[model samples]
Target chain A: MLVRGVTGMARVVPETRDEILAAAARRFAVSGYRGTSLQDIAGEVGCSKAAVLYHFANKDAILTELMAPAIGMLQALDERIAAHSGAAAQRVAGEGFVDLAVRFRREIALLRGEFPELLQQPAFAHIQRISERLIEALAGHPERPAARIAALVVLAGISEACGEFADIPDEELRPALLALVRRALEPVD
Target chain B: MLVRGVTGMARVVPETRDEILAAAARRFAVSGYRGTSLQDIAGEVGCSKAAVLYHFANKDAILTELMAPAIGMLQALDERIAAHSGAAAQRVAGEGFVDLAVRFRREIALLRGEFPELLQQPAFAHIQRISERLIEALAGHPERPAARIAALVVLAGISEACGEFADIPDEELRPALLALVRRALEPVD
Candidate 1:
């Protein structure tokens, strides 16, 4: 019985960490990272501040881990997008980007200005290359300044809209989002 | 000579106040409200902390004043958008919204997650109504959830992109942005 209980307790440890991440994400989304407090997250998780700190060294540690998956997925996207060029690349990126944004709506929301000096941070430095490549792949016309702006809007807009209208059922929201993206990336007149 | 010196000092007061507001906006946009401090603003303005406080009570006060013009413009956009219905309304709002966003790009950047509990603030409460109406006007097909999502993406996307690509000249950026908005609002296939 003692050994069985130890195993169950071990399982609960990971579960508790997941719960803390969820709580932190919600608070950061709704209150902004500045507005959220360690105690606030602990309170939501039904844990002590000390316990929360034990799982994650600090708020920044929690943020780094919480956002790792999104950043990793962006890397995966960069590779897939690398296979194609011009229109083919844009098509793959646009569809993949939309799906990624929807799948990680909350994570994307956290990206907008969550770290304005994002490139300066050692943890977030690689984002510059991945995002630049992604934008390059998605841009409608590489030479024109306006074309680049449109791509920025489409990608940034989709990420933000995911969180803004998160409650909208995925089946209903995905197509509309994709349709808008297609229009933005259509050949310029 | 005493009166002339006094007059010069009075003019300098407003200039100092303006300086403070400008410094705060840059700091807030970069480091975020939570990351920035009164001392940081003062340091930027080449003024003392006491001087910054004298001009504004605290960080929130400065935020309110600096964002007042942006909010006021949003209110104005609401009136212009109210004049039309359906596509016409979307056109007016889309163009007007993009223009407003560009004109106040930094302020719009500050809006994203700058205040997650924005509606709760008494000063910013009216934004709830204005933004809802603006999104309603910009949405492609009112009957579908997707259209609403599109509108949200367009408006939010423009605001964020304005800050992200602030370097692109207005003449080059404007038409391209408007073109994207028009495509997003086009009749469904």
Candidate 2:
């Protein structure tokens, strides 16, 4: 019985970490990284700040953890698009980018509002590289002005949609965002 | 000749204020509002921090003065659009928004990257109201979810385009951005 109880407690540990992360994400999204403090997150999570620290080294660690999954997904999308070229690459990258944007809406909100400082951090250095690579893939690796501008518009559209339409359900927002992105990328006459 | 020299000296005062604002805008864009210091702005302008203070009351004052013209332009656009309806309003607001986005590219860059904290200050309170009114005008005052989403996407696209395509000359970028905004607002079907 004691062994079973120990196993049960082990399962709860990871759940607690996730709960802490969720609380941190919400706080950071609403108040911003510089504006939010550990005490605020702890209050939201209903735990002591020290207890929050026990699960995460610090607030930056919490931010890093919150974004790690999205970063990994972006990196994977980058790899997936690397195998394709031309319009095929653009289509692949676009679909994957939309998926990631909708799935990680909160993180994208934090990023859109606070990217300069966040991206400048050494821990997020890879995110900048991955984003540039993703942009290149979406632009079909073209250095042309039109293609570059189109990629940027589509990207900005996706990020802003996620933040601005918070009241809309993701199921509704996903197709709307993808359609808008497609329109933005349509050939200019 | 003495009077002319005095007039020239008077002109220099406003010029110095302009120089200080330009330097602060650049620093805020690169490092964000929280990360930048008054001393840094002074350094960039090759003046004492005290000289910077002489022109503006504080860092927040510098930010407010930098954004005041853009906010005023938005208010004027809002009033102009108030008299129009449906597609006409969207068109007018879109053109004005694009022009402001391009003309105030540096300010838009700072707003896009650091808006949440910057907008919360009391001095910038009017900016938030003006932005909402502008968005309403852009959306043709529709409370519908799709229209609201489209307006946001277009606004975000324009703002992001101005920041991302800094190398593209404004003359070339203006038409490209306006075209993209129009395309993004087209019916999804």
Candidate 3:
């Protein structure tokens, strides 16, 4: 199959669903979910819109596919954190959250600024629940306002770091981000 | 003039453009920019869509007006911070950024998750520039990658705190957010 590379040159490649998803994810990250259209994705993928629809039911389907891996990983981390207690759980939650943010930086960047619109779609409902669980774990399941606020700041801080430092290779960004999160989560003397 | 209170009961009062903007701001903050329509604003204000259109040219107009004050205040803060040097500038930027977030908590909530969409609208162009300046100020105008990353984290942390803790009166949230920013900005000694 022929695909248009970033240089606009025609190159032979396998026409696979992953290619379509990669194109969609790139477009969504750059243009935003609301700003991107299925046609746009198809254009980027060098396929017909109907061909794109053949693999995914709709744009929401594409988004669901794009985020499913990250969501699954988060849910698994949520369960693991739940199985722990105190500082252990907070540590697990913090590390897991940052790892996921680093791994899925593009998806995070795409959704971070478009959360309100994402919430309105049924496909993204699990995000809120997963995020709340992560926060709860990060706060060590505490009911105190300070812990909750701290957890939120850490989460937001990591997310924003990942999004803004997208050009930085993950290996370099991951430790830097984890260090920041650790400092932010430290108890105030 | 009549307006609909939060209880859905009609209250007789003088209808004014401020009322429409207030209603639109509330709706946008709660439901999001794309989720809201002029009719929704009109319904909230107990006025007609025509009345809303009479005051504002379009939805973007309402959003522009809603954010103008915050933008102006941020620009002023930017100028003030620009006059300072090194740690002094960073300190001023941190406090001013958090103060602005606390003061315009509702507006922050409305815009926090809608940045990509806002960028598409020409009315919000200055937000990008102001945000860059704030980030630079927060970094003490440093050229280091770590400093830049730290500044981004501080800004995002305070914003997320304000948006999530909107119900916690500004007086209470201000100190907590400032404390978080201060800690996040500390050097990694």
* Tens digits of per-residue lDDT for model 2, A36-98: 899998888777889889988878898888888888898899889889877787788888998
Output the lDDT of residue B8, model 2: 40
Backbone clashes for every candidate come to 0, 0, 0
For this target, which candidate reaches the highest TM-score against the unseen true structure? 3
Each model's TM-score for chain A is 0.84, 0.82, 0.83
lDDT tens string, model 3, A42-151?
A: 88877788888899888789888888887788788888887887888788888888788888887777676666567657776776787887887776645767667778
Ranking by lDDT: 1, 3, 2
For model 3, the stretches where C-alpha displacement exceeds 4 angstroms are A1-12, A186-189, B1-12
In order, the Cα lDDT scores of the candidates are 0.77, 0.75, 0.77
Q: Considering summed lDDT, which 10 consecutive residues are worst modelled in model 3 chain A?
A: A1-10
Candidate DockQ values, in order, are 0.68, 0.56, 0.56
In order, the B-chain TM-scores come to: 0.85, 0.80, 0.84
Whose lDDT is greatest here? 1
Please estimate how well model 3 matches the true structure, expressed as its whole-model Cα lDDT: 0.77
Better of 1 and 2 by DockQ: 1
Superposed by TM-score, candidate 3 places the C-alpha of residue B9 at a distance from the truth, in angstroms, of: 20
Q: What is candidate 1's CA lDDT for residue B89?
A: 86
Point out where model 1 deviates above 4 Å.
A1-14, A115-119, A186-189, B1-14, B186-189
